[model samples]
Target chain A: MAVDTKKCVGCADCVVACQTENNVPHGFCRDWIVENVKGTYPSLDMKFQSERCNQCENAPCVRCCPTGASHIVEGGIVLVTHDDCIGCGACVEACPYDARYIHPQGYVDKCTFCIQRVDKGQNPACVDVCPTYCLHFGDLDDPNSDVSKALKNRSWYVLAPEAGTEPQLYYLR
Target chain B: MKEELMVSGKHIAEIYPVLHLWHWEISLYLFLGGLAGGILFFAAYFFIIGKEKEMSTTVKWATFIAPLALMIGLSSLLYDLHHKLYFWRLFTTVRFTSPMSWGAWTLLIIFPLSIIWVASFMKDMFPNWNWKWKYLNQFESFVIKYRLPFAWILMFLSIILAVYTGILLSAFNARPLWNVSILGPLFLVSGFSTGLATSMWLSKNDAERRILSRIDIFFILTELFLIIHLFMGFMAGTAVKLEAFRLFMGGSFTISFWIFVVLLGLIFPVTLEILELNGYHVPKWVPPLLILFGGLMFRFVMVDAGQITRFLY
Candidate 1:
């Protein structure tokens, strides 16, 4: 996934859309918005970014899960098998992004990039509902894919690059 | 230049991961598990060295407490588990890379062995107690016959169990406070010290208490060394790790970590034990009780402070 920081307005339509589509429990969210402001008041530079699970290539959640409940699925989407999860909260603590939480039903839950929709050949709900058209989702492996093209045209960065998670989510500056 | 940042829509309560996930249950479990491991290790060590008859408290009486501590510790872990009924899943698979898996499997082996270790000494502890069934009698004899091998296995497993408790927390790289390599050894030495303190407290023999107290002082010093190294490593590490070091240095956890865990828990006990060893009269119960208190407080502080010290703000 690629997010264009300049285009985002911190409106949080994507956050609501994701919660509604995923049936995320009340007061919890699979996606959120961050606003960063830099410089003095007269020359302030601000940016709004939508964030969620990075779908890390070297995901710590999968590595630390004792019961193998948290695993990576097709397209590198990290997922948790509800029944297999013992809900010991190891994955929740292991995640550098703090992207996971124990569900009220006793399992770890996180953003799967809306894999159910993606498997059906649709964009994630957050991507589809983004009003500024800033949230871009596509196959980075394909050279002509929208995500690849977006990254190719803009200088981008991932959150906590020092963490070595190899996070797939990109913010286009 | 100063910069301002604001985040919105991130209202997940579990976002405060430590507050929602690991709490007193984990800390208590870690303490009891370490205590059990320490007790079993000393028991097996003395039995293997032919000192079982001389150190009756270390080898026999303390062995009785091992299984109970483990059961309570494991019960706390079970109570903390969100999916209590599905806990058997921990045994269905083994992931060597995962510390929790290692811990689960280790406990599976140690728990039964602890009970059997106690059972093997039943005839010695009670001269006239007999098993109702003939097969039970035969099982006891078999266990006693190969008791040497059991002692060796118990010793090995106890070390692993003691160290595993610390490694479980240190394995989480996301939490900078717990990401140090020294944690495993630190916890091991601390566990052994607490184990010795317990044995010392229960022993009626003056010689046994002096020996155990001396050994405990060494373990406490080793633990202090490891703790110093842990902080030194963190201070020399990346920015996030330095922030983690600061949590115990002068941050919210300073009093708990320094005063409770260091001064009262380790220093005070060490001083008391040393005085006792030097023919100075000190209350028999004070040092050991303080050591145990310090051990418990150490786990509580580490677990609580570790949760607050994350890689990300």
Candidate 2:
């Protein structure tokens, strides 16, 4: 998923969509908009970056999970199965972007990119609900996919990329 | 000057180095939990072998006090924050990228689990409690049925909490003092030694002391390897990070690391454990004092040396 800051209006509808689709409990958020507020008094640049489970290529959540509840499935999605989790919350703490959360049911919950829908060949609920069309989801491996194309042309950065998470999600500045 | 400092100068990135403070908090938690886990494991050993009578009334205190102390010590960490509510936020999220998150999750999980596990042995210790409750009488049966499994869990969490606390520090890429992989294993060993010593000192049973001393030997040998490995890793780290080693070797912390953590924590206890194994049962005070003192010293030096960091950032 690639986020276009130019397109995002800080609506945070995508965050709500990810939460609702993933059954993220109240008080725990799987996605966040880092409102980088700059400048005081007048010339303010409040940059809202939508952050979630990056589904990193070198995902630490996968490595630190004791129960194997957190792992990267096919389609470049880092998915978590709550039923299998003991709610150790290692995945929540391991995400550098603070994307994962301990759901009320006592398990690590995060953005699956609506894997259930994507598995059925439907778009992610977040991408669908997004008003500004900032959140782009598609195959990065396929050069022609919207994610791939936009990423190729845009100036982008992933949160804590140096942490070796290799998050699939990136932001277009 | 005050206005410049108050504004968002370059100071945001250079402010008091919050990450280092986080690491220091984690390291202190490691030491405290490690000691708590160690001492609890010692008490569990006595229970497993049914050396209850051999254990003095002190062992019970050791069991009860250590975890309570650990709970208190671990709590001190949250107050060091700008907002205490944010610390509780740790439990609300599970980010695997931050060891603090992992530590928070693990501590929350293990803390209660340990409390329950230890409660079984404790309820009986508190005979003066109101016997009015119907289930109070059957507490014995409740404990008997689940004691072993709970004890096992206590040990498992003990190891996980102790070792992972070390792993928590080492997980960071920036701090050289904590980046060693051996820290996890070493901490477990140190924790066990510390626990055994605490149990032994609190225990009044000569026979229980004998058994604990034997176990001490086993953990002592393992700790030596882990300490060596930790040093080797520190030596191999980048020059900037290698300050961890210098703190132990060339700095003021050298004496504490060498005398207390090494001699008292590792060597002396092992030496005493060996004597008991050979012909003579070493003096009752010998091993336990060494272990406890050593463990505390390790923590003290770490806390002191870490504050001396001069990061090249």
Q: What is the lDDT for B286 in model 1?
A: 96
Tens-place lDDT per residue, model 1, A1-173, is 99999899999999999889999998778888887887897999988989899999999888889999889887888999888999899988888878887788888888989898999989999999988899889998999988999999999999887878899999998
Model 2 per-residue lDDT tens digits across residues B205-231: 667667777877888888887778777
- Model 1 pairs in collision: none
Q: Provide the lDDT at B202 for model 1.
A: 92
What TM-score, computed on C-alpha atoms, does each candidate reach?
Answer: 0.98, 0.58
- Candidate topping DockQ: 1
Candidate 2 per-residue C-alpha lDDT over A1-173 given as tens digits, one digit per residue, 9 for 90 to 100: 89997788777787778767877665556666655665554566657777666788887777766545677887778887665565544454445554555554555567788888988878898889988888888888899988898999989987655566567888899
Candidate 1 wrongly placed segments (more than 4 Å): B17-20
